[model samples]
Target chain A: MATVVAVIASTHHPFYYRASTATGEDRPPFADEWVRKILTFRETLTRADPDVLVMVGSDHFHQLWLDNMPQFLIGKAPFYDANWYNEEREFGLPRMLLRGQEDLSGHLLREGLDAGFDLAFSNELRIDHSITCPIITLRPEADLPIVPIYTNIFAPPLPQPKRFVQLGRTIRELVESWPSDLRVAIVGTGHLSLELGGPRQFGPHGPDPEFDRRAVEWIANGDLDGCLAEVTLDSLHAPGNATHGFMDFMLMMGVAGAGARADHVDTLDLFHTMEAYFTWYPNGAPTA
Target chain B: MSRYLLNKFLYTVDRDAELVERYRDDPRGTVAWWEAERANAVLNCHTGEASTWLRFTDAEREALANHDHVALFSLGAHPFLTLTLFIAMFERDHAEPLGFQKQYAVRLAHFDLPYPDIAT
Candidate 1:
């Protein structure tokens, strides 16, 4: 059976990457420090040496839009490449010529359909900061083969917290069913609370600590039902629209399986957003 | 009317290099084509654009005509595409592209809504 050796989930905002090198003295102290932390965590993930990394992230109107939006889509392209440029310049994120696992992707497509998910498939998808920020920060070398899954959090009629949990479970089952000695790692990227383009746009709006605290606690304790119950659309939206990143966290919990305890949990309060890092070892906690 | 026409217009320019080129070369022709293809009578009534597309009232139309980044966002354009629209408009002319982003952030700041630091 294919073994999921490790799981890592954290918040990824473009600011984390951009602000790291930004010159402004007004920039928060944690901005550069957070980048360093992610780089360090990447080394830990590299030591795990998983054959494939399954990335779950949301699109930021880069790849899909109102014209052809899909609730859940997976990239099956032979290679994934992106050049995310704001008006100024390319974010200088590394271009990934990462390989896609066709056999595994095909299996997932079939499984999702059988499992009653009208999951969309994209063979020519270009990813944005959602996938790139984490990959560039964690694996700047871009050596790992990746299977990219996108959830529609930008547009309305988003998938519920429970649906994300179900999808996660489905992914876990599919990975386990694969007949190989392949080691897989799951990485979920997004934030705890962020409101963008709304009334709370500037100074006063902040990350919902209460919500972040409860959700992280649930994940660290392997409380699947608790996570689903607590991370509802209303609860997430209470902090801000961008708090949908919490869905990414729930999805990772599903992959870790019910009662899959985290060996390590680190939380960072970035003022406007909360970031959580979770590491789980499936076989058993490695002895120090 | 829904903002479907505005969304489609912006997305067309975003994905189609040829359209963006056409828009850059002949703004009037591009707007004419967009109006014919996507904008309906009701949308025209709301936007207050004439057949020649000379006059526009709605923020979406005004922003499109003038390449007004702040106006487009204030009119409730998608935030991602709002950035794209800014680039499409001023990336060539502006010495510092971040100026347009700052303008967008300023416009957003006027409202009570929460804004992304990317614009600031």
Candidate 2:
């Protein structure tokens, strides 16, 4: 039987990848800083190596649509790989690190559905950066196998803040019920406060400490709804700032069963973009 | 490494860029521009003072270039940013310039033009 060893929620800003890829004239001067934060987070994740990573994040258009999009989609490939192909038609992946744990993916999908979520399963789907960038960052060599769980935060008619919590609870049940002894880590990626492509975007820069603090406070206090409500597109000052990335937290909280203790790593208000990170453990015990 | 300016590129007509044009229209070039810049696309319609940034992986760029309508709903940006980014990517002979803003107190933020894809 597999038990989740850890749950992590992080902020996502693809700009980090762009910064890494930029050249002299096109690159920003702060590329080093961005790269540093990314590297630091990667080191943290690597230090806490678990058997399986249940990646919970927003699915951007690669799967799901107004016509066919489901509220939740679970990746069930046996040997899934991350990394989008670059110009040379070569995958810019650090390595083909993440293998697919179809068994866990299938188990979680069923438990999620039984828990009242409209969960969808995909055997042929490929994992994207929402799952990729962070995975590569954490398991730099791409050795860890993954079971990706996507939320419909990108499209409207998304799961309610309350519903997402419920989904998390169901996930906990699924993890606890696994037949084989497995180690798991859940990761959530999105944003904390930085909004994308709206008036709020150009208005401010860096993680809104006030906003980020409020969110962290809510989570530290187990105010799940408060945390969820704080990260939505409408409530967030900027549209893109919807803490779609933070959904991973809710999932982790669910797995932790409302009593897990969390350790805050770094709260960065990078470049007007909010990227806060935290790690949580079940039963307040250290992960093996 | 070969770099392609989005505005100067051409793409297959039936791809995502053309499909995107069905929803948004602008004075810039056509869908090919966006298709070319799909991996790192930016949108600059409002003014020099403000713009939205978008970054897509090659597959994401291809899905958009191929005009996969479903891609629109799953991405992070709102519809306007998504549409504008798509439009600019397809527009011919159009490219947004690069510049920096004091995004954070200690760091300077960089963005690509037409709407530069903000990196770092």
Worst 10 residues of 2 chain A by lDDT: A84-93
lDDT (10s digit) by residue, model 1, range A1-288: 888877878777666656676667745567777866776677667767788888889887666766567999988877887644431243445445677776677778888788888899999877777777778767777787788999977676678988888898898888788777889888887677665544343323254667777877888888997777666776676776567777888888888878888877877666456777888888765443
| Model 1, runs deviating above 4 Å | A19-32, A85-90, A202-207, A286-288, B12-59, B63-76, B83-120
Best-fitting candidate, scored by DockQ:
1
Q: Please estimate how well model 1 matches the true structure, expressed as its whole-model Cα lDDT.
A: 0.69
The 0-to-1 C-alpha lDDT of every candidate, in the order given, reads 0.69, 0.55
Instruction: Look at candidate 2 and tell me the lDDT of residue A23.
Output: 92
List clash counts for every candidate, in order.
Answer: 10, 41
Per-candidate Cα RMSD to the true structure, in Å, reads 6.4, 11.2
How far residue B3's Cα lies from its native spot in candidate 2, in Å, is 33
TM-score of chain A of each: 0.90, 0.82
Q: How far is candidate 1 from the true structure (C-alpha RMSD, Å)?
A: 6.4
**Weakest ten-residue segment in model 1 chain A by summed lDDT:** A197-206
Give model 1's docking category.
incorrect
